[model samples]
Target: MPSGLYRCIYYSKNRIDGGRTRIASEIESILAAARRNNPPLLVTGALVFNRGLFAQVLEGPCPSVEKVFEKILRDPRHGDVQVLGFEAARERMFSNWSMAFLGQSREDQNLFGHIGPQTGFSTERIEGDRLLDIVRNLAFEEEARAA
Candidate 1:
């Protein structure tokens, strides 16, 4: 019997620069696969750094998603990837998203800061920003970096 799959979305922040971008480079291939019409386990996510903080959102199967996240945190650039608030979705939120997302904000750092700690990192590592603003800024910065 196959285990059930889930869609999990959470964000984390770290006190570092270029870390998110470097992670981005590493995930370029995975991201491309995620952008496909449909992929197995449907894993996709991103990480974005701003003001000495790196924020990210990941979505996919529970086990596979967790595995990918573990690999990301071990990347030396990531630290304390605390869960902001993840839901076991009936399906994918962004059919176009996979692995990890970069440059997004926590939106409610205070709320996220209350979720306790995971992997020795506290919710205190959260960032405050509007979701739209974070995504937009991240898109711009990523483009500039590529140029």
Candidate 2:
């Protein structure tokens, strides 16, 4: 029997509450953690941080995705966690990324108009499907740019 596949997209505040001038350190720490933790559980995903918000897609075995998401919720660095999308996916959109981080570069900011300077994970400003599309497109776009 094949395992069930699941995809979850969520948005959260992008502050490391009380941390000082170490956002880069904090983000690297999170990525390192994901790299170490995700593979064992067969989880694959990408994370985006733009306009002071975090939007991420977690896709893999249903249970594994849930487990990692729950960990994300418990982490104190993130706030205002909201699930944008959660459903069964036909396949992984970010199979190559354990946790790819998309920064607030000019290019990244231009990927979606909704992620402007003032935007911060508002459901009213971005729908679930659009959020998924943005992340998926970001993954591919970034890859193409890299290549």
Candidate 3:
């Protein structure tokens, strides 16, 4: 049921109270390399400034995903960016998106159809409850901090 060759959960946290400028700098650095890779990447989920971490799901071809992570791991801005946890996804949560760039927002601005109700992620074999649980938990933490 899975693409097998590719799937990864990008779990990372910045130094506590790194602030938006710090986070943005990190993102910009990653994007610089991501743009070069020219790979199909969908940022299905994100936990920005959540519990002092910047976590997300980056799904695509295995090579591209690995390359992205390698770049991130090597980036100076990714100070203390730790890979917390993850699993092999059955399919892609954000399949439709060729590339997904995200920031902290709650308005459900889904670039890929997979993120919103239109794609029906459950039908695609993704565990909807689990996915949402992670997002919600992180959102609660991030929103509280932002507030």
Q: Name the best candidate (by TM-score).
A: 2
lDDT of 2 at 39: 90
lDDT (0-100) at residue 2 of candidate 1? 39
Task: Give per-residue lDDT, candidate 1, residue 126.
Answer: 36
Query: Judged by lDDT against the true structure, how good is candidate 1?
Result: 0.49
What is the TM-score of each predicted model, taking all chains together? 0.48, 0.84, 0.51
Q: Which candidate, 1 or 3, has the higher TM-score?
A: 3
User: How would you encode candidate 1's per-residue C-alpha lDDT over 1-147 as one tens digit per residue?
Assistant: 234555433444543346556644644644564455224646755545444445555556787677666665665544555555454655543444443344334432432222335322242543332332354455556556759
Report how far off residue 135 is in candidate 1 (Å).
Answer: 5.6
| 1 versus 2: better lDDT goes to | 2
**Local error of candidate 3 at residue 94 (angstroms):** 1.6
Model 2, 6-101: lDDT tens per residue? 999888887685443477678889999999999998889988875567888898899999999999999988898888788898888888878887
Rank order (by TM-score, best first)? 2, 3, 1
Candidate 2: lDDT over CA atoms?
0.78
Off by over 4 Å in 3: 15-19, 35-47, 84-87, 98-103, 106-132, 136-147
Candidate 3 TM-score, C-alpha based: 0.51
Residue-pair clashes per candidate:
16, 0, 0
In candidate 3, the residue pairs with backbone N, CA or C atoms under 3 Å apart (3 or more residues apart, or in different chains) clash, namely none
